[model samples]
Structures are given as C-alpha cells and as structure tokens.
Target: MSTDASGGEATGVPVTVTADAAREALSLLEGEGMDTDVSGLRLFVQQGGCAGLSYGMRFDTEPEEDDQVTEQHGLRVFVDPASMNYVGGAKLDYESGLQAAGFHVENPNVESECGCGESFRT
Candidate 1:
C-alpha cells in the first residue's frame, strides 16, 4: 500500500492494506456498475453504535484536511485523524463467497463488537 499526501502511517499507529485486498475493493466497485468515476474510497470510525464505534466506508471525490490518505489499487483511501486510534494497526480486506462478500476490517484495537457486527468498542 502507498500513503497518500505525506506518504507515511499515523504518528504512532500502524496499518496495512494488502495488494490483493486493494484490487478486490476496486473490483467490487466496478461490479457495482455505478455511472461514476469514483475518486476513491474512504474509511472512518463514527460514534453512537451499540459497541461505541462503527466503521464507515464511502466512494469519495476528495480528501479533507484531517484525512490521513492512502492509495492502493488505483483508489484513494481517506481516514480521519480521530479514527486512527480506534482503528490502529488494522488491515482492510475484501472477501467473497457464495453467502457473503465485501470489505472487511481486521482491527486489532477493537475489544468488543455487537452480535450484529454493526458496532465495536475498543
């Protein structure tokens, strides 16, 4: 994976996005068949979930000032500074199977998660 802007990981945080995972993300977006040239993919953590944290991803057009951007598989990824702690040392992957498939986040910092997999607590 390549860092976006300044070209590096968070000040004290570590994260990795494998090449295969990146390609898979791009593939899924293409398969979605949207009439859009998605500028990139963005990931963030938000509050108010049952587990205290939730992961959010979107196909975006640009980066925000506080975004820690990263690029992989020709797609830009934006992550907010505040979400760094909640997702520290995490990795994002794309999975596919007959029953399920999508972007999956493997976060080491998450301590607890709701049964529905919609929220997490660190």
Candidate 2:
C-alpha cells in the first residue's frame, strides 16, 4: 500500500463527494477543531445490518498507509482498499428536507437493500 495518491490513480476514485456532502463534512470537521488539510472523512463498508453489509463513515485525522485518498468540492475523503471493492462508483450526497436530512450514498454496485434502507447487498 502506497502512502501516495496512487491508489486513486490506480483504481480510480471509489466514491465521489457532492458539494452538499463536502460542505457538511467540512463544517463538522471544523467544529471538532480538526485541520481541514490533514483531516478527512473515512468512508467504509462493514459486515452488519440486515443485508449483511452496512455503510460506515467518520472523521479520520488522516489517511492510513493503505487508504485511497480523493479530494472534491474542497473536501478530502479516505477509502480503504477492501471497502473500495464494494463502494466503487458510489456518490456521496447530502439531502435536506422536512422528511429527511442527512448524508446518503448512491452506490451503483448495490444489488439489493434491506427494507429499512440501512443495509445493502452487492
């Protein structure tokens, strides 16, 4: 695993972050006093949820040695190699409405999702 941005160049970016999502994430990071230049959002897939796989995200201080780092809309995103396999070609977006307001991932690799819409199978 290279510490450089080669992971993105090699496999392409696993996910794309929308303007809204980037804005929200940057704001959250600022609130936490994390430097925007060194801190970023970590997006990954974990085994769980009713569909056997669930999406997980959090603020990471920096990318790991094996993490694929990509930047868009003034935000940096980190994705590990294993998780990249399942989330490749996914888009991260933020929605705000009376019914719902949160970050959502539009993943092209999804084959099916649970009824509650919390988990998916690829």
Candidate 3:
C-alpha cells in the first residue's frame, strides 16, 4: 500500500493499520492455521445494530474479484466496494487495558457511534 502521513492510503478503498493492531491480527491469523484456509481478515459493515449499521469482521479464505486489498505492517486487509464507502480512510487499532482488550476502528466517516459502541451512523 502507498504510504502517507495520515496513516496509509487515504483514497478509494483505503484502510490504515496500526503496528499494534497488525501484530494482534497476525497472531490471530496464525492461530487460525493454514488448514482453516484463512488468507486474511475481511472488514465490512452490515445493516443492523442500534445505530443502523454494525461493523463486522471475520476470517476470509477467498476474496471476491472486486475486493480491494491492502497490506500494512505485514498484515493483509480486505475491503469490499460497498463497505469501502463507509470505512474509507479508517484506521484499525488494538487496545489492551485493565477494562478492555480488543480491536477498535477509528473511522473518519462516522458521525456518531451508538451507546453500546457496537454500531455507527455516518
């Protein structure tokens, strides 16, 4: 992926991965194994949740021909065209603390996120 000051790519199907997040993702992928056929993590949005749309991610073994792929910090991320509209220029971050430990998305396009923090509205 092209490098930029903002994080990674900032245009069309763009996604930036922090080094911490990339390490976490790589560890998770390694646990899934070659037998599971997981090539990378697929990021997308689904219509639901309290805020109208929920972010979803899962292991993807096969990527669609139209999928936009980006490699950052040694981890591969896949984004479909439809989801790109909502998550372009977003950053994937991993946080670990006494209260919470998980992956969080920092999306510039989001106007607000629900109280539960599971969904967002543009």
> Which candidate should be chosen as best, given TM-score against the real structure?
2
Could you say which candidate leads in lDDT?
2
| Model 3: pairs clashing at backbone N, Cα or C within 3 Å | none
TM-scores of all candidate predictions against the true structure:
0.76, 0.91, 0.86
lDDT tens digits by residue: candidate 2, 1-122? 21335543546445888999999999999999999988999999999999999999999998887788878887888988899999878999999999998899999999999998789999
Q: How much does candidate 1 score in TM-score?
A: 0.76
Taking the candidates one at a time, how many backbone clashes does each contain? 0, 0, 0
lDDT of 1 at 112: 87
Model 3: per-residue lDDT, tens digit, 3-27?
Answer: 2223444348478899999889888
Which pairs of residues have clashing backbones in candidate 2? none
Residue 57 lDDT (model 3): 90
Candidate 1 lDDT, tens digit per residue, 73-118?
Answer: 5656777778877876788887788999777889988888899777
In order, what lDDT does every prediction score? 0.71, 0.87, 0.80
Q: How well does candidate 3 score on lDDT at residue 54?
A: 87
Worst 10 residues of 1 by lDDT: 1-10
Residue 62 error for model 1, in Å? 1.7
